[model samples]
Target: MTPNDPIDKGDLLNVIKWAIIGIVAIAIVLAAMAGFGQLNVNNVITLLTILAIALPIYYFVMMLRSSKVTKVERSRVKAYIPLFFAAAIFWGIEESGSVVLALFAEQRTVLHIGSWHFAAANFQSLNPLFIMILTPVFVWLWEHWKKQPSAPGKFSAGLVFAGLSYMWMALPGMLFGTSGRVSPFWLVGSWFIVEIAEMLISPIGLSITTKLAPNAFRSQMMSMWFMADATGQAINAQIVKFYSTDTEVQYFLAIGLVSVVFGIIMFILVKKINTLMEGIH
Candidate 1:
């Protein structure tokens, strides 16, 4: 904002006001979805309710407190949005695919690792478990690299890995026809690929905001980082509405193709995007 364009107190208040309105609107839509049998889980509603309350409160405060943007900084901030958005979309689809994976997982069986066995009910933690084990090794590998992808390139690579994760699942869904449970190893394999993608994306995500964000809009850009993920998950919610046992195979194939296609495009265009970023990597 220019010096002449003073921050109106009412305008600032209005931002918070509209934030509440948007949250309430989403809450209503979620409530309606739950009412209509689209979503019926207490845990999901509780998470949404907490997000409805907490996210706006955090951002409203940030909006009030953040400094004004300069024209150059504004341009930089604009450049990062698409990059963050691309990474966020990867997160959305890959993570959302987990829910679909579970829809096909064996409910009555157990999964084995080494000497240990786990019931299907505990399979949800597999991703995090993979993440915890792999992170240090990945971090070490990253540290040893002489040349690295630009921030945009790293994000693109993550997208490709994410797409590959779904493609792996698509193979089984295609072969198994969703009529009976596939081996738990399919779930294990899919989770393994995603956790690898997360390792690539998550570290880059944590760093790029600081590297790329405008001084005036640092916090706001970070907020955008989060919003990108939220937007992707919102898309996932809609996608989930169409998924079922019968459609599982095709669902994985379609999304996998979309992600991989976009990822290839992103990989091809990474240098151009990085050039547009003006050395933010």
Candidate 2:
């Protein structure tokens, strides 16, 4: 349609509704923060971060409910909803590589290997390093494995692996005690495991997002894929506050188990979720 074409009344009204909601939400957050003396740079950044994640998700839901979305498209979008949340949870753990995990590397682990000292920050490189190493291996495996899992199945497994990565972190604190530094290998092992989870979820998630997208909202669905990452990081900002040297083991176990339990539930409901997919697989 040309720019000169009149905007539909319903569309204009919907846009206005969202604009008003956003303004009020921001105002409320700011007022609450100011009241508590928490209206600072970091807290404001967190608020913006959550908004960035939430808006796209809200938009995606609205898109699915649009009159242009067909019955089958609506069903597929319904199936996509579970996957989106699964992705968000998976990412919350995976993205913590730079935040919670970084803190572990810096504060908990011994940053030396037999007198060859290194920077704790160096541990961050393990994420991309492992991704490069694992991507090709997974690319080959997916081609040769004949009976690969569906996207939902892969996402479930990814969550388990991501959970295990945190569970691995809990062990060093559990065995060695959190007051003293443990081996840096603990961080190494955790990064390795989470990267394996990424191999399952990241690429497959991108491909599946494309497949599951309703025709009218194709590009918007891809944005929804990225919003999962934002949502996870936004959650990370709040949850990371709970992660300290004092609460090391409990924090790791709590978040880890949540992902694992959700994953197991998803696995049990795989058949039901697939049915909702309406043969997209």
Candidate 3:
């Protein structure tokens, strides 16, 4: 495509729609299989094992039939190594911090105070309700901010927002006295604050990946983006398993602190990375 050519936005939308449909269809089929007792845990494991073995062989065969990469492209790929590491570390810290916090809250003595279970279930609706209420206000604010010449720097702002969200959770613990029963509002508020950070950073991160990766390696680059998420989840699970104890709250607090620290570091690196990305794009 020529530099001045307009992007086919409709075609992009159609591709996205089909991808979502395919994912949903696969999910439905998997659910049906499990429901029918044809897809037990063992069956799932076997399927995964077969796929894992087959994918590399398939890819290698495709490569053999295709032209080899030149040294210049190889160096270009190597240049992304630091970006990948930074992305992975950032994701790992953020997710692991969340796992720690959730575990901490879980370790809290179940308060039978004032219909706690019912309140907790109702609290699940709190976020959606807040979104429904605040969305218009948020949109207006976003538009106003967009018009400003000095709108906040995206990555730095996102990290600051994340830190603020963690602080929201921490504040309730301090205010209510950790041993005493606290309001569910604290958790809900914290979630809402963090969701804002998510809305900001997630899309920007994806945009950065697409802009930076070479055309030939774009798919692999996207896969690595998601792999960072998977890696974070795996690490979270392992950390939770090892740290399971009455000290879950302490673990969570520690994780939150680490997240804040790493987020600050990420914010510091944003300018350098953004400069690198400008050349790549």
Against the correct fold, how does model 3 do in TM-score?
0.56
Poorest lDDT segment (10 consecutive residues) of candidate 1: 103-112
lDDT of each: 0.70, 0.88, 0.53
TM-score quality measure for candidate 2: 0.88
Backbone clashes under 3 angstroms, per model:
0, 0, 0
Tens digit of per-residue lDDT, candidate 1, span 179-211: 655567777888888788788777778688777
Q: Look at candidate 2 and tell me the lDDT of residue 5.
A: 27
Q: Give candidate 1 misplaced runs (Cα > 4 Å).
A: 1-11, 14-67, 107-117
Model 2 C-alpha RMSD vs. true structure (Å) is 3.3
lDDT of 2 at 75: 85
Question: Each prediction's TM-score against the native?
Answer: 0.76, 0.88, 0.56
On TM-score, who's better, 1 or 2? 2
lDDT of 2 by residue, 1-281 (tens): 33422458997998799889979988988999999999998888787777867676677678777987888878888888888888998899998988898888888888889879999999989989999999999989999999889989999999999999999899988898889999888889999999999998999889989888877777788889988888888887888889899899999999999999999998988888898888987
lDDT of 1 at 183: 69
Model 3 ranges off by over 4 Å: 1-153, 174-177, 242-249, 279-281
In model 3, how many backbone clashes occur? 0
